[model samples]
Target: MTERKYAIYDSETSGPRPRYDQIFQLAGILTDDSFAQVDQLNIRARRLPYVLPGPKALEVTNIDPYSLDSPEHYSPYEFAVEVHETFQRWAPAVFLGYNSIDFDEEIVRQMFWSNLLHPYITNTKGSMRADLLIMMRAYSACQPGAFVIPKNDEGKDSFRLEHIAPANGFENMQAHDALGDIYATAFMAKVCQQASPELWEHLLKLCQPRGCDEILSAPTCKLVTHFGVSETHLVTRLASNPTNPKQVCVFDLSVDPTPYLNLSARQIAERMRTDFRILRTVKTNSQPVLFHEGDKLAPEVTAEVTSGESNARLMAINDHPTFKIRVAEALSIRASEFEAAPHLEAKIYDGFPSRDDERLMREFHEAASWPQRKDIVARLQDSRMKQLGVRILMSEAPQVFDPAYRDKVKRGMLENRLMPPAEADLPWETFASARAGLAQVDDPELRARIETWLDEQEAAAQAVLAA
Candidate 1:
């Protein structure tokens, strides 16, 4: 079967910015290799103490305030811990979402970052990540009418769950709600796969990170990857040195790089910095679809896009003794420059302790009782681990921690700026622009509804200030 085990999930957040927003709801369903549901989770968390809810987001999701304020809801820390434990069971399965690679996945990473859990869990332990929207787009471009394509307000095709679900005959009245979206996404995946198995298989293969290593190491390649709604076919050769395996460097064979080859390494690097098309290098682990010199492509792919001549020329350039060495050297120089900027380094793994410290963390996470977990965290040697531990203790079992320690952890979090900063001038700043935009709206009902929403929001804000 083309279908593989996947855990479809979705998140409803306070706003769009992952770094600044907070996710209040998380819903996931674990499916078998055939995409059959094995387990599920639908958790609503208490609002993060740090973030003010985005009014526009709140209005759209229409989450019940009573449910949010109820004692039954999971605190942010509790939710994080529960999600971590739940995912551990579903792990090593491809993490699937509608358009999660760009949004929901990042929110998961930030949640883990704040909670001191492994942020890159989706990619860790032989697992993979896939997006239904990407495959849907690819299918729409290559094999139109395989599934339903909903039109937007402009009568153009839209991949949004709000439109796609109903168009495809899937119930999605609760569109923005987390669990509702997950069910719709899972059903969409199943429908697409069942309708066109071969295309579905090909797209799923593209999402996996496994095959890229072999493809990137090859002498010549026909790389087929989706950019926007269309796929681009490029004949590329490896350009980076062996030292930089993580960084993929390639020369585009369709366009000649020989003229640029005459330039000095620094000169080539400068041009590359400005125009990426001059020399293309994407990370190998990003799962680009590669077909070496003689490998067959999909039947739907046209010859003009994947011609034999282009592949042969790519082979010639790679085989040229001097070409490989020179490009590798140039890439090494450019990489060194990027490495110098320390702040640019990723902080996703910041809280993850060393291998030795993993044992303590594991014990803390696995302990049956909250007191046992607290004791384990208190005994930890690492400062970061201890800080995380005490904070978790204060959050999970506040009664155990004395008032002094609880206050200290809260103060430390603020002093260190661990909390996400609020966008003080928010909807008002966007509201003015939106009103100006509404001038273009011809639909009287739609315009009236938008204006009403804005007025209601303003009233709510005024009432809060008055209170």
Candidate 2:
């Protein structure tokens, strides 16, 4: 069998929201199966034209706003394309990073989706993803002595890459820097693998979609979850969503299963809402830490419930014929509560593009001229693709449009950035909100730079509106 490589990566973004914000710096190191570095990449990009950089994000990253506009940096689209291509070139590898599955991964998907590229490249095409932060949480819970898990000022365990990495002997970790964080993550991975080889191997397997399914298939299992702090739960798989098999609904064994066994689908759904703790939704693809019956568990967790009682509860839940069906119904009901997002970026999960639209997306990227790209966008079958394609043209190739239409697009973009709808809740940072954020910035120099940038943006918006 061929040994798989690890594509460890990190990204520094303009803000927290993946849909609204943008990745400014993306860096990664490709390593052999043994964690020996084979190749590396670091790319920086200017923010998208319509994106308003959050002041607090700028403060934490210590990135100068003006520096993003430097000629050497790639444009947002270019950066996205480069990153996408690089990851594609390093295919069939495990895409690992610190806290990446939650934040950086979303940013990558959004960047690709917004840029007319395939969004699921990392998890598809023989590739999978792993998160060091999640791994660390599991390691600390399951094998506490493997590495030093640092505590925060509040006495809680600090799983922040910067804190945990240094504590585990990654001495030169640069916290907010993308490339530095990748190195620190790689170091931590090596440490975990060295200290507890068996557990490390098991945790790494959990990166794949089917990794946890076998363990979850059993009558009873132990799950280590982190919500501020690590907590172990005796869990039994109730049902996997028919629509999305990755979403497995598990019943907490500590909670009495007898009351739920005979409940109707509607009643189970009601119980799910009233007592939220009864059911825990675990995305198997997201690297959940799970242990089987014979696996050694932490003493604290083992002491919480006797093995005999937990196994009996699991057997009871498993043996009930209609239990899984009702749980599946409840899962579907709970999922239906979230309304469809109106924004194009947030509509990414609406559905997969048609074959014709997918072909056009590739053509749209390959088209030499802006007019050709615009024409291709017009031919797109999906409305979401067409809309996103137009936005791309407006940002990258507005010259292709008629003078009046170009100006209209520019004005609309400016207005969206400066004057969003009063009643609508928007995720993007706006000029008003960015200006408001200025009061929180303590550094006078940074504040002045941000203020000046905001002033320039306002003046520009006003000019476009006047036109």
Candidate 3:
């Protein structure tokens, strides 16, 4: 048989914002060099206290509110350390995954970084080797005659790596669980390798794109420049031009030279209210009727149109045909600007994801410690040392020495903000005993000393949470 190839990895994160969220769960199944399963990995990582999971994140995890399981229950960083040190057992000759590019890889890489390990540093040359989503989007043809293939841009049936595996006859158990994620990726990899060998072979050469550059675009980056998400949809790159159905009405006076006759720019803008109609098309909601200064009648003309708002300057018109004509012309010009936007360059294809799934795996390798996250570690260290110093000062318990915040010495919250899964997993009542025990020390110096240790413990716990 051909040399065994590929470790299939999978991950479930707190949300889209990887750096800010936690890697709560992970799964991996190592296959031979040929994408055949050989070994496995599964884990539930601790979360950080500051992680305010978004609605989507919350829905996906459906976290057990009744249970209290914080980083105090386990150590993700220590786990990463162990995993990196023993990479041979689970790592396949080659690695693969479904949507691993953004979700799985990122969760793991960040997990390692948060844990203070460099096992899978992202953005570094030669650090990781995959990004399969791009391959499918660029090379594979979508299911024919499908109207509105879900989550896919034009030229793609569906770019979601998670969906491809199951759609193409790969096994799926529990998604978002670490081990399950791994198995799904492995299974999907096998399916893709067999079904689309040409695409698969080409994808193996891609490299990773670190720091959210390749996975998803934001206001700063653009996607429509590459390919239309659908055949009927127009490509959109402007962040301000996204389609939002919730907007009741939009008045963008920003367009040049009004496009309506006998009406002012303001008046035309008021007419575009969506309380009566809302267009799903990109950028059109921001437009209004063309205002032209036709018969330059009194500049105070007002048109009583749709359902109401404050009786104010929002509906007045100047009746200049040039203004209205200019507005229409302005839209034409703006449309052309959007047309000239830069296309997606090949350089953007930094990672060679192996067709949708592996492409995603390659794109999302969580290889680096989050930028500026070291503060978490620093705070832990500082809290420990400062708590100790303060205890030392109070160690002697001067007869008349009164401090500004001395009350905290006994009754203050004992959380080491650094503990992974910042929120204590145990019920608040369970830790009551531990907290009470920690609070009962009478020796001033001993109390101070204990604070330092507590700080360190909290820090380490927080680190675990972060990992």
* lDDT tens readout by residue for model 3, 1-467: 54645555655665664444556555566566566556666665554333323333434554432121354433444455555544545433444555455655655655554443443533332334454454344233322321122444454556554556566555655655657556655565555566656545534533322222221122111111114431111111111221222112122221222233345434434443331121112321111111122212102113222222211112322233254343343334333443431211111213332344333222223424322222222233323222322332232232223443543442232342222233455222212233344454555554554445445545654454354
TM-scores for the candidates: 0.76, 0.95, 0.42
Query: On residues 184-251, what C-alpha lDDT tens digit does candidate 1 reach at each position?
Result: 88888888888788767766666654566566566655555555445445546556555666567676
Clashes of each: 0, 0, 89
Report the C-alpha lDDT of model 2 over 287-375, residue by residue, as the tens digit: 98888856874324633777788878877877878889989987787677778897778998899999999999999889898899999
Runs off by more than 4 Å, candidate 1: 1-3, 64-69, 118-121, 225-227, 240-246, 263-268, 289-316, 319-346, 350-352, 367-386, 397-467
Residue 329 error for model 2, in Å? 0.6
Model 2 has an lDDT value of: 0.85
Clashing pairs in 2: none
Worst window of 10 by summed lDDT in candidate 2: 296-305
Give me the runs in candidate 2 sitting further than 4 Å from their true place: 262-267, 297-303, 319-321
lDDT of each: 0.68, 0.85, 0.39
> Residue 420, candidate 2: how far off, in angstroms?
1.7
TM-score of 1: 0.76
